[model samples]
Target chain A: MVAQAAWVVLLLLGIGLLLQNDLGSRLALFGIQPDLLLGALVLLARRMGPLTGLAVGFAAGLMQDGLMPDHVGLNAWLLMTAGFLCGHARESIFWESSVASALIVFLAALLHNFAQGVLASGFNLNASLQLLLRSGLPSAAYTAVFVTFVAYAVPRVLRGRD
Target chain B: MPAPRTPSDRAAFLLYIFLSFVALGVWLSPFPSPRAWVTGAASALYLPFRAVSKGVENLLGLVVEREGLLTEAAELRRARIGIQELREENQRLRDQMDFARRDSLHLVPAWVLAKRSDRLGSRVLINRGQLDGVRIGFPVIGREGLVGRVDALEGHLSRVRLLTDRASAVSASIDRSHVDGIVEGDPVEGLRMRFVSYSADVKPGDVVVTSGLGGSFPPGLPVGRVRRLGLESGGLLRRIEIEPAELPERVQDVFVLAAGDSSRGWGFLWARPVAPTDSLAESVRTPRVEP
Candidate 1:
């Protein structure tokens, strides 16, 4: 319970920083972003399991939806699916390197954004594929870089606990 | 130890697939507006949060202003000038209110919070919603020109479908020649004015504004200036590219024009005058101008 609480707090803080816009502006030059939230979900899925990851993803997505101006519950649904996919990948594949981790994160982010675009359009929200690509690609690239760092740091952070 | 895969796993997978399909279906389905409930809830919830955030931002600004870092008289004068500019801006908005009233148009001011991140597409979110009398199809305009239309309304939040969306079509004309054409967005960035006759005198740098042909927008709102003009392969119609007068990326505030009911049909304000010479001229010209 304590671990879960800590995780939630950390996730919320990251999201809050991202929502503030000031932090993003400051760190945008270094390509450092608040995508650590996504990285954390991926790592949690690998270490804990799929069900836990699913719950985390849903909660994180809900937080995102609340903070953002887009439709409510959209990100929650997308992130939950992304988390499930990550867990499934972990069970099926033997990805051991940072490069693989980056690739997975990139793919997951892309999928999430694509799902958002599709959903937005389905609702007659006037979203286009070109717009999705322009926004999603860079966001995926940035998330990948963040995930690499998180993947490296996760083991160090969890070494003595388990 | 081998990971266990139970019957439940199979069931869960099936459920997941079904749910995924359902989600996809919801996305594709055209009937129930996806934005109806979600937007309403989000906007309603955001009101207090936005208010709090704005308060905090203003407090921070106040602290910054009171720091007394500007010791020089010149800097103090500059600060006074800035305040005067703000006052003038406030007065201008007040004048706009008067003008709007005189014109018999109702205006609702909305604060923009976020823009669609893609450069090619145009969409924006405003902090006014159903609670603020904003409804879907409300015309959005910035200081200089027409911005877009309210595509979705939640509660206190609404999404503005920018004039640059591919699905967005505005009945606009050259201010000088009054040549009518529809301005549309390319999948790529910027707008393309379509259906202009090859004989039309449209040229680069011609100012384009809403012709008020369609009830969708008001007349005389600046759309953009012509950037390029060319002929399509058919040589039947001229293709004109326009650079939008108002940069969609930089807008912070917009006004929503209330949708008014007119006794006449759409584009009633701009209805073609009866020539009395030809009956067909009235019918052909009328339907063509309806947005």
Candidate 2:
């Protein structure tokens, strides 16, 4: 029950962070938006494994989609897939250090953006390729930086509690 | 030792797939009308949180105000001038109200609370809703000119779809030449005036106003000003670029015109059709007048 409550509190904090405009600027250069919520999902998946991560991602994505003004359900679909991939990757790969974690985050960010771009294209909402390059590349780098810290800390925190 | 795959994992994957299908369905389906109940409930829930945030913001503003008063005297002087301008505006509005009473045009004031979160779309939510006599299709205007029209109404909130939205199109005319064309938002930004004659004498900075072609909007409300004019490669028609009269990003207050028969204010134009009535009767009349 305590763990559940803690997770709920953490989720709320994550939501609050997502709502903030400056949070993106804190990590990203220029106007690119690193997916902060995705970082949190990765940590959760690492600790609690695939099923829990998938559930959390779905709920978070649904909340994001509903609150946002875009076509509903876009975020939910993307985030769920991200969670699933992250969990599957964790089970298969053995990363011993922070650098490896950053590498994984970089690759995941690339995949996430590619998926988003592909879906956007299918919907005919894709913007200029120049815009994608300018925004996408830096965002992935920043998210990788964030994951390095998070990936290092999550395991330690969970182990300490156990 | 490796753990066995669990039932929960299968369930979660199935749930993810179900949600994705649902999402795809929503995206593919015809755009839903704004959910009034959901919006109203959300607005109600947001009120307390907004109030707390506003209180904090106001407190911060007070501190800044004090600091500005002491150090930013020039800025304060400019603000005083702005306040004076506002006072003059209030007096003008009072005079306009008196004129409006005689003219039969009623103006209702509304406060704006939220803007649409979609960057690609242009929509705003006003505090007044169904309870306040606001309905879908009501025209909204800012202090400078026409803003947009109400697209959806909840119990206490209504969404205003701005003229700059790609989905919106307004019939407009150049003030000087009276050339009619349709103004619509480009998917990128700003508006494009289409269907103008190739020979139309349109120029940059020319004012565009609503032509009252359709009963959707009242006549003569300032819509925008032409910023550029260009001919398409095929050269069949002219395209005029326009900057909207209302800045969609900064508007905070607007007026909702009461919805009723538009003919009430258009009586003068209705009178014009009377002149030809007598001539037509003279041409059609025969010896039947004796009967």
Candidate 3:
């Protein structure tokens, strides 16, 4: 359990660093990059339980928020909710299917962006709903593709190692 | 599929909500918070990565956007030459117009250090500051035209609020029609020349320039070209949207015009006789500063 926790923390830090480095901008498709951190959170929540999801989500989101100029708590709020939902869903949902994994990632990303738009409006951050959707939808699709690939390959790799 | 929510889930949700609120509160507060330090540190840690990424992007740009970049570079060179010619021409015009020598004007060159990340706010930081004689309210001009005004000053850096900023307003006139209006910046539309008389003959492609009425910007400096014209809801004033002469993305260096004779540029206008068909009332037109 301790080893798993350390791995999760390491993953969060690595993702945080990568996102902040702006590789996302280079990889942007239609002015949207895959939300790698969000994918990691969703995957973690699916693998772990609700409690671990909540804690990891908060930490990862806070790290992201720390790098941003404004809207410090906005990501934390969104990611926490995402993690919680995914964590709870893990109990009943089977992640063995790659299609389901992609769907989950897409839903998570959509929720994250929609929540971002709502929060931006509340904070008067000048991010319009139209702008949010324009960037968000593509980002969701991109992240979903990556998550699907990971979902397919990771299990096989682990089984091979065993 | 619905998953059963346990007591633990409820408690965790509440805790997360509470933490998020605390963070929100800290961000909203005007006072300094530890969160700023944390964010700054995280950003600092990413600086080397950013530098590397920038280098890689530039390399890729050379490969992919070679033609576009070359075209832009050529355009910039042409613009620089044109600006130099305009500067020399303006010097001669200034000598002819301001024969009385009442105003002292000089340009100070400054490098654009950084651009503000906030999409809503159009501001930039320059390297020149108080030590370099840069001050608040001084006009900053790019190679193309009017860029912005110095909004704030520090020991070695200054903030310039661009003409496209919502708070910025400039007294301007249509070059051909001489219709006077107050130009204001809009985030959505580039710049809007407001409160022109309804009867004023303004149209698309008309050149707009500073009238030098407000003392913030000098007279005769090009601000933008009229892109579109419309009548306001009140119908009393005509609304004119303008495309800013200076493209913010291409602006690298700017000259701060400090204490200049802006009024004297209207000498040519004064020398020309008015046509009778141009029935623009004197009250509607702003008075030109004369020597």
Candidate 4:
């Protein structure tokens, strides 16, 4: 369990490094970059159950807070909430179909961006909704594209190894 | 799909609430830089990543520098070719200056302004005219040998008909045999010596020069070598083909000798003495007058 948690932290660190580099900006689609961190959270919640999801999500958020201190603990709460909701439905959702898995990631990313915007705007509902309609749409779509491959490959590789 | 409210689930829920409340406390805390410890640990963990980032930046800089160097190399290549041409032109001008001094000749140096060739053969326009002592029938020569004679003149420009022109003719003789013949230009055969009898002692490789018979051209000026020899159809004269002393197409800078007694001792150009036959000079026109 400790090894798995370490892997999760390391993975997020890799994603954070990419986000801070020129190569990451080059991969942006129409000015909206994919949120791979949020996609990983969605995958963790769906596969690892709510308890594990909550702990990992909390740690992920704290790391984010460490990088950006402006919103010190906001990411922790928001990421945990996202993890709980995805894990709640983990037993019911079909994880075999890539399309269904991608859709789940897309919706998760959309809600995550909207929630972050609302909290950042101090609960300004109009600005949060506007963000969801504008940058959030393309950003979620981009994350979905990234997660689709992850969802398809991770399950097969883990199953094959098992 | 809700999991039963087992002991573990209840404990996890309580844990989630505890963590969230603590995060909320920190958000509302008054202390600035409260997460400095967290940020410090994270920065320490990322030390290697920063080094790698710098390496990536340097590699990109090298790529940009490579492209700039390639552009600079292409510009330098073009500049090198232009310098080579200027060097060659300077050498040619130096040789022309030397030739004028060694011969002790009066030469009016002129740059060929324009050149053209057609069914009439070749002609060139030089930037010299009657105002510059450039008269009609004045002999023009490149550093090598006879080029042509000036045919027309303007106030500041004159046209010279090249020796290879169809209407052009000069009295020349073989240097070895001292036999004179009319060297006329033909569009097909470059230069042919007519009137040399079948029994004339002329052979291939013999040097032909101006006999100065018509006094139109200086005596013993390097004309050309006899390339081929044959008998005329009637068996009366020999068919002698003379290669030109100068390639008419390539003459750029030329010197026009002021017409008169200037070419008297000019036979030294071919190491021969003046052997003027005035009887032949009277027969052929001194200056071929044409429009």
Model 1 iRMS: 6.1
Summarize candidate 2's per-residue lDDT along A105-154 as a digit string, tens digits: 77767666766676767734355344457666677778878667666777
lDDT of 4 by residue, A99-133 (tens): 88899889988988998898889999999999888
Interface RMSD for all numbered candidates = 6.1, 5.3, 3.9, 3.1
B-chain TM-scores per prediction? 0.53, 0.53, 0.54, 0.53
TM-score of each: 0.35, 0.40, 0.41, 0.53
For model 2, state the Cα shift of residue B291 in Å. Answer: 99
> Which residue pairs does candidate 2 place in steric collision?
none
Better of 3 and 4 by TM-score: 4
Worst 10 contiguous positions by lDDT, candidate 3 chain B:
B265-274
Q: Per DockQ, what order, best first?
A: 4, 3, 2, 1
lDDT of 1 by residue, B1-291 (tens): 123386645554555555545444433446456434444554454455557667887999987866655455668799899999999999999988755444455678888988883634567888887667665566788888888887665567777878887678999999989999999865475788999999998889999999988767778899999998899679999989988876777778899876332222112342232233222223335432213
Indicate the DockQ of the complex predicted as candidate 3.
Answer: 0.18
**Cα misplacement distance, residue B181 of candidate 3 (Å):** 99
Per-residue error for B89 in candidate 1, Å, reads 40
Docking quality band of candidate 4, CAPRI definitions = acceptable
- DockQ of every candidate structure: 0.04, 0.15, 0.18, 0.26
Task: Estimate, for each residue in B253-284, the C-alpha lDDT of model 4 and write its tens digit.
Answer: 99987633333323234222322322122213
- Pitting candidate 2 against candidate 3, the one with the higher lDDT is 3
Model 1 regions lying over 4 Å from their true place: A1-44, A56-76, A92-97, A114-135, A150-162, B1-34, B40-291
Q: What is candidate 2's CA lDDT for residue B209?
A: 94
Candidate 2 falls in which docking quality class?
Answer: incorrect
